[model samples]
Target chain A: MRGAAQSLKYLLLAAALAYPLMPFRDVYVLHVLVLIMVYMVLAMGLNILPGFCGLLDLGFVGFYGIGAYTAGLLTIHYNMSFWLIVPLAVLNGALFGVLLGAPTLRLVGDYFAIVTFGFSELVVLFLTNEIWLTRGPLGIPGIAPISLDVTWLATLLGVDERWRYAFRGEVPYYYLAMVMVALVFLVMTRVEDSRLGRAWLAIREDPMAAASCGVNLFAYKVIAFAVSTGIGALAGAFLARWTLFISPDMFKFWESFLVLCMVVLGGLGNIRGALVGSAILIALGEVLRVALPKLGLPAETRFLAYGLIMVVIMRFRPHGLFTQVAESTMQSSLIKDLRARIAARRTA
Target chain B: MLEQQLVNGFTLGLIYALIAVGYTMVYGVIELINFAHGEIYMLGAFLTLSFISMGLPLPLAVLLAMLAAAAIGVLLDIIAYRPLREAPRLAALITAIGMSIFLQNLAMIIWGSRPMPFPKQALPAFFSEPALTFSDVTISWMQIIIYAVALLLMVGLNLIITRTRVGTAMRALAQNQTAASLMGINVNRVISFTFALGSAMGAMAGIMVSMYYNTMYPTMGYLAGVKAFAAAVLGGIGSVPGAMLGGVVLGIAETLGAGYVSSPYRDGVAYAVMILVIIFRPSGLLGRAVTEKA
Candidate 1:
């Protein structure tokens, strides 16, 4: 019954994915969809660390800014193409992860969380105050749009140059984000199925026990941080190119907190849950953006909604709307069934 | 210039100490970081403003505001925290964050976001007059009162914890809740009392801060709260004297950093010092070495 329900859920999800890819495109709808995809990618990066590894990173957006600025700066100063800057941004992000993860080695729980929060605020301050490098609050504008050079393909196929296009339109960016999301989802799933993933879960469940079992806690934690950073940076780089502008104001503690909310709202330790949470919240934001102003409400109400939702979700469903592994449920039921069987045998 | 800055820093440190004591006492008892403590401070300031605006006497207004903040702090515990007692630590932490955000937004909704000049008339006539003047350094009656009142509160808090029966109950609960409860101490009541006491102190700090800065806003809590949390950590998270010591040290460091280093990064300087302290001494300066129970 559970398997059938899961398959049905997947079938509907597949249809939903296909609906957006249809030839007919609404710019406004596609814009929202693109944002959802972007947030999903970012949330998935965070999902891996806090969800799988159980390390709460309050400064995930610092790596994100590092990635965006890496791509953004190279585009502005070096005239490097978006394609070329992607790998560089990811490397910088991973390096930052190592720098941050190392200090957090001895830390645990709330202490680690506060340190990360401080680090995030420091990052924004650095970006804002360092006017010489980042153009300060003025922001970098007119970043060259990413383009696919298909002229060679056009010549070979005897087709027109119309086949070549820059990734500026909403539909193309949507496809770009979808491809990235698929890649991250695939990698996350494989990693989650691997030994490292199990180790993280073990650590999350009981750090002492995991350490007793010979899992090098520090190394595994760093790997999780680095991987999350790399993926998050990729999303940031994409955001920079897609938006064609960069500013310190765009990356705030609120953004990091919102992403954390997404991970928590979706089931932590579950990949699909992050997607669901991100989609729903981003959709809600887009709707609120249009409607709240019309109702003559202050703009700060959005944060109020986020905070209220977090409180409600946590109070009612502590594990979140979605939950962790099915194996736990199966194991508990199996134990119950075995206990019953033993009782029956004794009676006989 | 140096003297003036030092004077300002010293006064600010005392204020931060007042807020830090709340964090330490609550943490010592419940081990929960009350993120909304700052918002409680914000509320106290706003409430005091409202009371003063309504023609209430200053002393009565301040007392009522503190009580109201205590009540709201209790409400926060009941709403955002009580249900998740046995849940994961992360849930409580998230709830605290949510509560912080909620209170900030609630304040914004209640009092518009613009910074308002603190009502000078709310203070007594003597507070409006300068009490002392040194070469290049001037101190007002209000500053003197802030020190005197804050010191009195701290001393009173110390006395209550060390000398009184409720203080003994709090100490017992902090050491071991289950054992304390077994010994006839109402654990829930003790916890609620700890929150109330801490929040009352925080409210008083808020009034002091609004007077010190002479400006009050809805979002004022975020920075002050974080700084006070840092103070609590630096002195020793659960140690009362540590919070006091840490707040002074942090306030001085921040003020010095602003004076000597870049003013824009003065806030970051506090965090840098905090991160360094955390790395070198995780138990904090005054915190005892805790052996992690497996």
Candidate 2:
């Protein structure tokens, strides 16, 4: 049965990979799909800090912005290769994450959230005001697309000579994004099922109890933040290559909120749910951008709609759509075990 | 030169303190940051502008604006909060963020995105004119009014918090919710009253800020809200006097930083100060340290 289930999962994954290619393959649609995949990576990254570790991170976009700018600057200024710049961006992002997390990890609840929010604002302000380095509001343009040397391999395989792969086109990036997303998803799933994942969950449920049980709260929290930030940076590197642009406005607090909404809407701590959430949110935002004008609604009404959707979702389904079963099971078992342990200790 | 910046900072600080009081008071009583209070402040400014444009007397316009702002605050609690009384703190926090965004966008849709000028005729003739001056430094009569009014409001709030029966009940609730309930305190009523009081003060701040800046815009509340939130945090989240002190300190920091350093870097200085304070003195200047019960 387990082997059958495993095969079924692989089959579903294959179908998903094949489904996007079967359409008419317009570049616009393909670009949206690529964007969705990128955001899925980001949402998964954010989930590590906020969802699993129960840290409220309102400035997640700050690291993402850093990653994009780093990649953009390196490729545009130093003429670095895309493969080389991507890892550098991730490293830069992880270093920043550690810097931010180390000092603030001791704070509890809303204080930590506020500090993170402030950090995010500070980053954007820095990017905007540091004209010499960031070019202020003019933004960096002419970012190069990723180039792969797969042509020789294709020739070796005797593939069709008519196949021309342009770096600017969506086809090459789409496959690249798919591979990254799959890798991130696999790694996150492994981490979630590992000892580290349990430590994170324990800290999230009750930090004091977790600490009493020998889990290092501060270490795990900081690690979660660092890992999540590193992943966000990777997404940023791709985003710079895909759009060929990097601007401070793109890393606004609202972008962070959107990612948070995706995590919450899709069901926190669930990797597949984060993917679904990102797709739905990105699609809805695009649809609303187009539909509001046709409906004779003003542009600002879109924000109103966004706020309403979040409020409604939070009101009705606080645990989100996908994580209901796991939450309930965990809550019940936790309570039962606590009761039993306490009674046994009292009797002893 | 330093005195001039100090005066400017103090005036701005007073306005911030007025708004910060609302945030601190609500938080003190309920432990929930009332995010919509900033929107209430925005509504007050817009309502004042609307009434003055319609030729209402300035005082009457201000009064009507305050009432409207207070009503919106109460309505927010009724619709968004009352149902979620039993919900977790995170849920309430998310809802507050949602309400804040909703109010901002609703204002954008209703009032349009353009900045509206405050009606010149609404100001008293003497107050409209510039007052004291020291060489190039100039102080306006309007600044005096703002300082006086803010001080008066703070005193009035202090009286209510210390002297009134409702004030005692609020203190009781804040100290211990279950014990307060056991003591026959009407928790819901006191919470509602706290919201009303906080909203009124925030509205007053909004009115003063609009008159001071001579402009009102739909999205003006966001930056001010963040600054005020920073002030509240600086003073200690649940302390009233801390909010006032924090606001003044922030105001002074920004003003002096702008005068001595680049204007573009003034906000950066203020936030940097905030981060430093949080790292070194998390309880704030005057706030008592709190221990989590776990």
Give one digit per residue, the lDDT tens place, for model 2 in B1-294. Answer: 888899999998888888988888888877786777788889899989888889899999999988888878888887888778786566677678778888988888778778987887888778757798888777899998998899998999989989999989988987888899999998888988888888988999999998888888888887787788778878987788899999998898889988998788777765676676677787887777865546
Candidate 1 local lDDT, B122-230, one digit each (tens): 7666875778998778998888988899899999999999999999999998898889999999888888888899999999999988887788999899889989999
Which residue runs of candidate 2 sit more than 4 Å off their true CA positions?
A1-16, A19-23, A150-166, A324-348
Q: Stretches of candidate 1 above 4 Å error?
A: A1-24, A150-164, A324-348, B125-129, B291-294
Which residue pairs clash within candidate 2? none
Model 1 lDDT per residue over A112-227, tens place: 77887788788888898899999888888998878877688888999767665777677678778888999998887777767788788878878998999999999999898889
TM-score of 2: 0.91
Q: Lowest-lDDT window of 10 residues in candidate 1 chain A?
A: A324-333
Looking at model 2, residue B161 earns an lDDT score of 88
